[model samples]
Target: MKLLTLPSFLLLFFETAILSNFVTADTNVHYLDNNEFFKFSNPRQIYGTKPLHIFCYQGKPKYIIHIWQSVILYINHSTDDYNQFDGGSPEHVEKEYLEKRYSWTSGLFSSKSKTFHLNPFNTSCIGIESQDTYSVHLKIIRVDLWNILKLVAGIVFFLSAPTLSKNTLFHYVCGVSSGVCASFLILIYFLSKLFPRKTFMYGVIGAGWTLVIYFLQILWDNMKTILSLYRTYVIWYIVITGTISFILCYRWGPVQNQRTMNLIKWSLQLLGLLLIFFSSHFQEAAMAQVILLLLFTYVPKRWVLAPKMYWKKRFPPKLKPISNDEYYEQGVRETAKALDDLRKYCSSPECNQWKTALKLKDVKRFASFIEGNSHLSDEEILEYETSIREEVTDDSDNGEDAQFSEDESS
Candidate 1:
């Protein structure tokens, strides 16, 4: 049985390989037109600053187009016209700038034609231009059914290789194989835009084999018994859900406040566990529960949270401390202001009555006397009052005739 399996596997592999080769041969033919021809020139007037060889194509959404170039030269693609390269702009002044610009591919020396696969996402037009002085002839072809079939074949081969083994570790092997295949799919999808088709295929095949061998060794050494009980499955499911929740929280939780971030993290974790628990109990609603969990995981946080919640608090700036000289200056200014206000108040007519009520004619003298003498005997206070009254009587007697004449004139 082992010998028969080996021969059958080889036969199946060769059959698929031969069929793929036939498909490639048939799809290699392309229809050409004179209008498709483009010329790139290094004009002496502009010093090769302008990209004369530009081909603009109307592109559809989610469609990938393949480009074949006849010369070894750097290529770039943009969603708009290549008018920016017409002048000696800062963006294209240096040779290295074109190499680092958007959707740029480095030049490679090759005997065969170089191919570029592009996905023009949502752009109405795509402009393909050569960054070098070399004259480039190229063809643009939209990916057709046969090309898609070839891609699907490659993907299937990558995913189905591990299943060929008849070992009891089928589940573990298939899991690892699928993960590696998905990673390669994403990598190839992006790399197809940056590398020629031949270079992209060579890299994918080489990297795929290396990872497959490494993962196989890991699986061989770590094989364990598979738990088959329903209760065990439930516990594993809950643990998996909790772990996914934790990762999501840490990656996409609120960052405006630390406390809010923690609250959101814990809430999501608890909610994930509860959903798993309830889904297990209510088997009929399990699908709905799973859908809800997926929505919570993938939905944009801004759509769920208010716009104001994303705002961060701005703290007031720190003030510099005042020096000793500054402090003394401030104190002097305040004291001068207070004395000016008191002088203005004393000029008013109410000042005489206030001074009489306090039995103090001059505010400065009253303050000095209080500071010097803490207490006074009753007779001393009486004598002080009698002296003030006798002074007042002398002033009144001196001004009596003048005050009486002024009143009569009024």
Candidate 2:
């Protein structure tokens, strides 16, 4: 894309404003008691609970995890009379009744957490009112399990699924996943600057970032009323995380060139950081940004020395096996023995590794399997290349062909 034009700048300027007002104006203003800057006061005086036993932020996409947690605390701590809006004196705001956002114009979000549309994670609960004598309990589970789940799934599916990672598919998976992982850490550093969710970045991204993104359905499936205290926690987590994925996929994930690849990653991530404040203000518009972002995701971008770039990015001398000869020697021998058992189970020792490890049969059979997949991946890659080679006019993606190359190189 080119530099922003005058018209483009003006358009985005107003877009950002409208977006900001929409997000901030119609949401809850009092969720936390972070002095007066926050929307709500502490739960100590408001309810009978011993403050919320909230899990401090653990980083990842839910940057404002702490802020959302505080809201849960206040809600869970209130008694029946806390905010009996309709009953008795309609002066008190029930603990269960919370403003959805921090906007001044928007009144409190009366819909229970479980009822919010975006809150597909069946988490929100019916706001229960306990007496001052009853104590409140708010528990926060889930410790970056989503990220781990994704990594495991990707590794297994890519390794097993036929035609999925043939050409350079394997390598591309490695490369893109590596880049994604790196970008996630980078995202934490940059995002923390704006929303400073209290959590250790290292632990959040350690080895579980991908799994957290994967198991989101679990949250969606479990809609327990007691989960009300943690409703904001789950909802905010899904929206921000999903939005980040949407934004990154459209921007950095599609590019080529190591320098450009990293550049695209960092630039978009930072821009998202700046825009996220706007998200809290205008949730809908903030979400729309991703849809607006799709305009660029499929549009092709050019590259120089594309092959060289792919090789260098995907397969450096350091990463290659010390000697393909010795490595494949044993593999070939084992594979050959298994060739004899062709129709039947090839229990040969050599082919045993592939058979057991990959769940393939004899060595020759596994090789055939790999070759079959390679053919399919190759065909797909060729098609991708054909689409992208010609001036990139309404063609396929740049990275689509990279999968084929990954297969060849592997």
By TM-score, who's the top model here? 1
Runs of candidate 1 with Cα error greater than 4 angstroms are: 1-35, 45-55, 61-114, 120-133, 137-146, 154-162, 165-410
**How would you encode candidate 1's per-residue C-alpha lDDT over 241-305 as one tens digit per residue?**
54554454446532455554455445445544444433222233434545565576668888767
lDDT of each: 0.44, 0.41
Q: Compose the digit string of candidate 2's lDDT tens values, residues 225-286.
A: 42777888756655666555556555644434566544544444445434432323233443
Model 1 TM-score is 0.20
Q: What is the lDDT of residue 200 in candidate 2?
A: 57
Name the 10 consecutive residues with the lowest summed lDDT in model 1.
Answer: 63-72
- Give all TM-scores, in the order shown: 0.20, 0.19
